[model samples]
Target chain A: MTQLRKALRPSTKALPEYTRGHNRSLVLQTLYRDGRRSRADIARETGLTRVTVSALVAELIAEGLLVELGQREETRPGKPATLLDLDRSAFVIVGLDLSEHSVFTGALLDLDGAISTRVEVELAGSTGDEALAKVVDLAEQLVAAATAPVLGIGVGSPGVVDLGGVVLSAPNLGWNGLPLQALLAERFGVPVVVANDANAAILAEHSFGGAASDAMLVKIGHGVGAGLLLGGTPLFGSRFAAGEIGHVVVGTDGGAVCACGKRGCLETWLSIPNLHARLDRPENADARERDVVLREAGERLGIALAPVVGALDLGEVILSGPTDLLDGALASATVETLRNRTMAEFHGSVTLRMTALGPDIVLRGAAVMVLSSRLGVS
Target chain B: MTQLRKALRPSTKALPEYTRGHNRSLVLQTLYRDGRRSRADIARETGLTRVTVSALVAELIAEGLLVELGQREETRPGKPATLLDLDRSAFVIVGLDLSEHSVFTGALLDLDGAISTRVEVELAGSTGDEALAKVVDLAEQLVAAATAPVLGIGVGSPGVVDLGGVVLSAPNLGWNGLPLQALLAERFGVPVVVANDANAAILAEHSFGGAASDAMLVKIGHGVGAGLLLGGTPLFGSRFAAGEIGHVVVGTDGGAVCACGKRGCLETWLSIPNLHARLDRPENADARERDVVLREAGERLGIALAPVVGALDLGEVILSGPTDLLDGALASATVETLRNRTMAEFHGSVTLRMTALGPDIVLRGAAVMVLSSRLGVS
Candidate 1:
């Protein structure tokens, strides 16, 4: 921080307008965290006055963000109080993931995080403008199919993203300095968020996958990258490129050359194609043989993750990619290696698991971004 | 997050009492961040009412927390405004660091982070109750020599500290579940904080070292550990053992055994003793040979940090140890290795530097913890 910037920065918080919005967010967040509750229950949980809760609840109901589901079924109550819940299906999120190498995928997800509609467009040869067009089209299709009003659009694209949602560079998509947020916001007439794919994945894990509020997600597919969440929020570094781990050099000297001109880079050792080449699995390889190969890959991944686990004392490490490649022996190897590499004390408390969100992890992550930015629930 | 806990937790913030204290803290923090300024200037920067600023300023002045620095020379102004600054010498802080092995040290620091009194006690054979007594004695001696009102006491010990400042365990100090906070608070009749030594170093780096708000501090002594900061806050994971990086295995298999029964833990490779053993500098060794040995140590350290940097997208790696061992060739090697291991693009922005605060880094860190916990400055 520079002296000039420090001089300009405010020490006191904002006024009542900001506080009011925060209070409103608290009410909505309470509803999301704790399901169906009476007005009195909400007031007690929120520490808001009865009158304040009632007013906010009324406003939320008027905005279709909440609904009264009649009286609760209490056995020994003189008068059953009315229960309020989030109007889960009243709004839908349009989520897109462009991380996949050959296709652009999208979906419409309800407030409950369930996908209601899905669409995709092949991008095997599409580049630059065409690829951007494909993403816009898929999102448009999902928006058109939504049964309720769309909340906003959230995108998980492959590349270095700026704070303002511009794609600084996406080598595979041949994009550089694209103002994706402005373009999509203008086209859809809704707020839009564009972030790195792995970052989106970690958000999904925190928002819905029951992963620890503070966790780490390592996505190993055509490329390897990580997403870090600390204290329930994504750790976007000073440059907003905090989780780009693919090109880390793992060896002291030459083994295989990387596109980044570094020898023995982690990408050369862990990416899907690299692993496949190293394994040399025959078409008829048995399960045991496959496990051995996966174990090797997983061990390498763990070696890479040892310092990270030790440095952050992270509690969870989520693997997201092909289940066939990451689960079973591979996942076990990664966990065991992490246990051996970092302190044994951290082994028991730290969790290692494949993502429960399955193959649509990035798409669901997009939905989580919308939830965080649009509704402030995440 | 469990459903029952979610239901039980209150969603709203504390009432006006907490808000009032927070506002006062904001005002003090503004003075600290922006240097000397007028009440009107503080009010404008903090977005607080002039009346509120006046009331808070008057309270602080009465409390001896602020002092009028007279009028500023302003050529463009018709009348010069009076300046207010932190009463740096009005209060003194007692800080203790237990990171050293054979000795325990304590110091008294003023508001400007400068030490005034120094004290130490030999712990060659001290352990358990005796060691605790020595610590208490050292603190009392420092307190007795203070020239002003003692603000509080802070301890940076080696252990897994709980939120309440209980030492879960500090093997070297032979402490376990020691209620240090309550004990010291009772003895001194003032606030006290006990945290892991690395965590304290990180707080110091954040509070006064001009380090980036989000950064890491690596202290290599008898043990190797790191302290992490994210978004201006220390990254204390659930176990409060977030920065314990000493036992991270640097080797895939056994080369040497660790005290913790792990083979080739990071401590085995990076501790000062281990580095000296590896270098084995003959009395007549040439400078080039010594450079090679230091370079190798630095490269090894960098390899260990590769995944951490990649996983966190960290751009700064600060090394704290004997300058003779950590700077020049060794620091360059670590920087080069980090550059090679992580993204080359990140290499341009990443920083690798020695501690500018010198050997008292942890002691100053103790003072930082006092400031943060006692006054909520961090």
Candidate 2:
């Protein structure tokens, strides 16, 4: 024992202080990914012992985060096994989706990932402080109405967000270097996560909606953006500004000028506002003519995305936001354009589908953020 | 006992059957990621028992793949510990880098990740089968010359590589749909991993070179590509072709045609060959000298990457491949261009540096692939 202590000194010195917490998080994450399990099963999966699993489970249950579900049937002739699962009502999380036109706030439930008590507030003007205040106010109301302890808040915003929670530049909102996360955290007295809106949408789709765990979620609303998910995790580029497909120059000469002082950006051709402007001609455009124009706009969106699809070889492409604008003819035209432009081998390998979350996708993603943070899974 | 048996039954029944070898591989992976430690440390880190770690270590040591060192000192007032590490001389891995113009074959050491031997073979005007045969022959010779047991071989080729090791395309090499992995594996009597050259380069940079645990590795060789690393894991887009930045259209019209049949691709404007063609015209009286031309080329490269830098918020960019051909005026021009084009707030946020491994970055990445696959770390 004395020799063991001496021998372990070097390793112990090198060991990070956060190892214990990380280990616990790993256990919780494994359980979360795999669902209910016995102590022995957890031990086997995590490479821990039954004793360690028992101790951890006990600690978790004591914290009201987990619950034992009594004996489960055994195949072998042995002692009955104890099953453990996350306590469904142990905690709740708040998810807020802040868009240029509207704000959505909701509660993401524990265990089952259901959204409860959701509210949508439209923005009169796209002011940073005004939008933030609306979000905070809605959050307070939701928290007051909550039956379970609220763990944290996750806000999905459009634009470049730093790790410090500062919105560096959101062209749509005209926000730059705003300490959004800090302000929200101070107000709510809980941890706050600020993510790119498209990234959050991707997370929502991957976790609960139609996008697979490895899909790329592209949101073509008032703007064009993308969120890349690999192995159930969002891929944040070095500066946390990955998946900005809007600014990827699609045309160099004589294309619509972008708000970012660039010409021929995908957003210039694919954005809802741009499409609407093109279709809403006061000169002589009927409603039926407008529908044809919108359908053509969708075809253009597909043409713009075809190169990206061929290059990335992504199997799933999910579209979200303003379904009325992207329905029927528009959807089919987009698919046809993609099919025509992509490689023959990848003809049917890619699936383009509308988001299944209706209007609550972004909000659900925000809730997922809070849940992920509380559970230390992300 | 009956209750315990009943409870355990479901878990036991539901648990997927995994082999002992797989568990052993997981143990090795944990050690590789967390570094050297005692059996207790391995068990603690991996959630396995000390007994299991001990057994695996013993087996590995007996197999000459691991070495047990003397006891290490303990930080806590407990038992001293035994230290175990991978034996550097136990095994050798062959890495191949198949670029457009040249083919580099090398043997990389285990544990320390040093290059044991290297042979650069320029691609002759030959058929695909001939080139493959030459690679196999070279690998055979390297394996025969090595003092250690050959664990595996890893090949980095320019193409879309499927899980089945098929090279979907290699326009430069004139190869398509080649079953490289299976052929190499069969010929060498060991596991072989075939991956995209850019992906391998990123992997090498992430695991053993400049990108660190979290960074995006952008390879600006004959074509522009990106490799994303988030939380020490590579982000393979849904179809395993996520980093095809070369095909990203950078101009709207009147640009050089890309091999993908697209006009104004980033690669068309930024690749070395393209730069040489654009700038090196002996007949043109007003054309700048070679030095000035290279600088301008670098500026164009930076311009092409500015949007990516802004969008991804990348911390640093590592420049690989023929530094002599890419350094001086071109490099400085690139830096200046990046600084000027990116948002002012993001100015100086990204640092550009030469790859640490020089031209061998791809080969090193291939070696990393073998290490990761065998250890199951990444």
lDDT of each prediction vs. the true structure?
0.80, 0.69
| Candidate 1 residue lDDT tens string, B113-222 | 78878998999878888988998899999989987777788898887888899988788778888988888888887778888888888778777787886678889888
Per-residue lDDT of model 2, residues B63-111, tens digit only: 6666778888878787788888766666777888876466545665555
Clash numbers, per candidate: 1, 43
* Candidate 2: tens digits of C-alpha lDDT, residues A94-132: 777775455444555555467777766666674767666
Q: Candidate 2 local accuracy as lDDT? A: 0.69
**Candidate with the greatest lDDT versus the true structure:** 1
| Candidate 1, CAPRI quality class derived from DockQ | acceptable
Q: Which ten residues in a row have the lowest lDDT in candidate 1 chain A?
A: A1-10
TM-score, candidate 1, is 0.92
Binned by DockQ into CAPRI classes (incorrect, acceptable, medium, high), candidate 2 is: incorrect
For every candidate, the chain B TM-score is 0.90, 0.81
